[model samples]
Target: MRFIIQRDHLVQSVQDVMKAVTSRTTIPILTGIKIVATEEGVTLTGSDSDISIESFIPKEEDDKEIVEIKQPGAIVLQARFFSEMVKKLPSDFVEIEVQNHLQTVIRSGNSEFDLIGLDAEEYPQLPQIEEENVFRIPTDLLKAMIRQTSFAVSTSETRPILTGVNWKVENNELYCIATDSHRLALRKAKIEMETPANYNVVIPGKSLNELSKILADNNEQIEIVITENQVLFKAKHLLFFSRLLEGNYPDTSRLIPNESKTEIVLHTKEFLHAIDRASLLAREGKNNVVKFSTIGDGVLEISSNTPEVGKVVEELKGVSVDGEELKISFSAKYMMDALKAIEGNEIKILFTGAMRPFVIYPINDDSTLQLILPVRTY
Candidate 1:
């Protein structure tokens, strides 16, 4: 395989595909990136079984030549070294040639490096996903949905299912939810579709996080195709594929309460800052617990106490608290996370009781909701 490509274009594609390459893979070939040069353009693929990312650079775009292919073939080069070499190449273009026995040479202006390449045939083939069930979503909207929920996924592998975010689509509506048993985040959006079909899929939170990072703030529509065990995300010139978890995600609809005893409307930033300050002291405590009390005269008291570090008390102004006045204790970290995920300036928090899980939502928006389980402070 031989190709001369623009340095900047190759660097961008390499970085995108590198997200799927894992250094800890048991297979030696998995540590390298597969490059294929064809008549159309050059394609770079990186995969680690669970996730695969492919980026394409056309030979000519907008009447400008981006890649010139001398021979049509494929080669796999070590990702770490190749990525660094491409980034530091001191020229506007890079020339790559693969000779007999998979020997590869990368050359720029005044420097050249030889890397032992593997046969691309050894790389595992990406699972083919038939476009039978396909849907489209705006890139920015998809990124928002991922951001609002992926953080709440459990990091522990004990319950493998909980490590992924649950994505459900029904009747032209998309819902994304994630929870670690202590806190839950849910986001809903209306989607445009022709035929309506219900889909319940669990995608690894880590994969979604990577996808969100790769999705730029553009108005382009992304095509999503789901098969029995794989999901494919197709952006302009990039394709991202992830393996679906095997177990059924637990039903979380019943976990959200229907009633509330106390409701408070407060500024998101105010509450977030209060929690941030309270966490300073709570961090010294056992479970990082902070107490929130609803007092008279539109005042919310934020306090935390540690046997060795004493206590802290702060009052946040500008909130309307109704129903029975209550005091509740919860993880400061959880509250801060929920507050950061909210998109509005004003937020409403609904508390069923002192011990029940409380829900947080934007004042006038029902499309997004966050729930946090209270922690007991003796």
Candidate 2:
């Protein structure tokens, strides 16, 4: 393959595709990126069995030439070295050529480097997913959904299913839920489709996190196609594929309480800051637990005490506090994480009891909910 391409465009594409390349792959070729030059454009692909990303640079866009192809060919180069070299190339354009025996030449400005390339034919083929069950979502919204929910996925491998985000689509609405048994995040958005579609799938949190970083924040619709075992996300000039986690995701609907014994409305920032300060001392404790209590009308006290460390006590006046008097203890880290993920100035928290899991969300928004299982400290 031989091509002279805009360095900036190539650098961006290489960085995006490298997210899927892993050095620990059992297949040796998986560690390198496959580069293919065609009359239409140049395509770069990287994969590590679980996830695959492909980036395409068109020969011409909007009547402007982005790539000048001298000869159409394909080769695979070490992903880590190639990506690093492209970023440091000191020129506006980069020229790449492939010669006999898979030898590759890279040049820009006054610098030139020769690299041994692997045959593209040895790379594993990405699954060709039929767009039979396809849906569309705006890129920006998809990124927001992933950011809001993926953080709560379990990091433990004891329950492999909890390490992923559970996605469900029904009644023209898409829902994403993640939980690590101690805390849960749920987000929902409405979607439009030509035909009625329903699905329940578990996608690895790591994959969603990587895909979010590659997507640009825009209103452009991203096409998604899901098969029994694989899911494909198609963006402008980019394609991402991930293998779905095998096994059924546990049913999380029943975990959310339908009623509450105590409810409080408070400013999100104020509550978040109070917890942050209290955690300063709580972090020294065994469980990093903070205590919350409703002292009087619309008055709440947050306190943390570690025998070895000093105690911290802060008072926060809520917008509204009603229902029975309550005192609950929970992990300061969990509360802070939930508060940051929720979007709104004012938040409403519903507590069923001192020991039951409590739900937090925006005051007027029902689309997003965060639940934390309170620590059993009275």
Candidate 3:
């Protein structure tokens, strides 16, 4: 392929696609990025079987020429070297040309480098997901949903299904839930679509995390399509594909409690900071556990103790306290994560009992909820 392209466009496209390329990939061609130049524009593709990302740079945008294609062709170049080289190129434009035997030359501003390229034909094709049952969501809301739930996914692969977030859409409502058995995050939103459809799929937390990072903080709508084994996210001039985890995600609905023994309304930031300070001592303990207790008269106490380390106790006055007073112990990290995910100044926490899982959510908002399974300390 022979093309002269703007340096800024080239760098951004390379970085976007590079998210899918992993050096640990077994496939030789997957280590490189496939570059194709056509009459329309230049397309860059990167994949590692599990995930694929494609970015397209138009030849001309807004009546300005971004790329001048001398000859339309395709080649694969090592991702690591090519990405690094493109960033350091000292010019506003970069010229790339391919000669016989897949040899490629890059030149920019008094500097030139030759790189051995791989045949683009050998690269694995990305999954062709039919665009049926597609739905759209605002980019910023999608990012928030991912942030609130993906963190709750299990890091251990013991129960592979827990490593992903469960996404369910039914009757124009989308619900996302993630849990690692110890803590759970749930968020729900209403969506409008031309044709109503229902779907339940498990998306890898890692994939959602990467996609969130790539998406800009905007209100632009992002098209999403889900198939039996693959999911596709389409944005302006970009396409992302992720392989679905095979297996039924456990039913999490039954885990949320219907009743509470104690309920407290407190400030989100106050609770979060208390847990952060208490965790400092809990971190030296075996399970990083923090103890929370409701002392009477709308007063709450947070404390942590480790025999080898010191103990800490802090008091927080709640806005409202009702039901029976109780003491519960839970992972400090889990509580902090739940607190940060919730959006609002004041939060309501519902405790079923000292041992059962407790739910936390923004006051006056039922759309988002966080549940934590209290640690048992005798």
lDDT sort, best first? 2, 3, 1
* Candidate 2 residue spans exceeding 4 A from truth: none
Candidate 2 lDDT over 12-128, as tens digits, reads 999989999999989999999999999999999999999999999999999999999999999999998999999999999999999999999999999999999999999899998
Candidate 3 whole-model C-alpha lDDT, 0 to 1: 0.94
| RMSD of candidates 1 onward, in order | 1.0, 0.7, 0.8
Query: lDDT tens string, model 3, 115-193?
Result: 9999998888889888878899999999999999999999999999999999999999999999999999999998767
TM-score of each: 0.98, 0.99, 0.99
Clashing pairs for predicted structure model 1, backbone only: none
Query: Candidate 1 or 3, higher TM-score?
Result: 3
What tens digits encode model 1's per-residue C-alpha lDDT throughout 284-312? 77689999997788888999988788888
Clashing pairs in 2: none
lDDT of every predicted structure (CA atoms): 0.92, 0.95, 0.94
What C-alpha lDDT, on a 0 to 100 scale, does residue 217 get in candidate 1?
93
Q: Kindly indicate the candidate among 1 and 2 with the higher TM-score.
A: 2
Stretches off by above 4 angstroms in model 3 are none
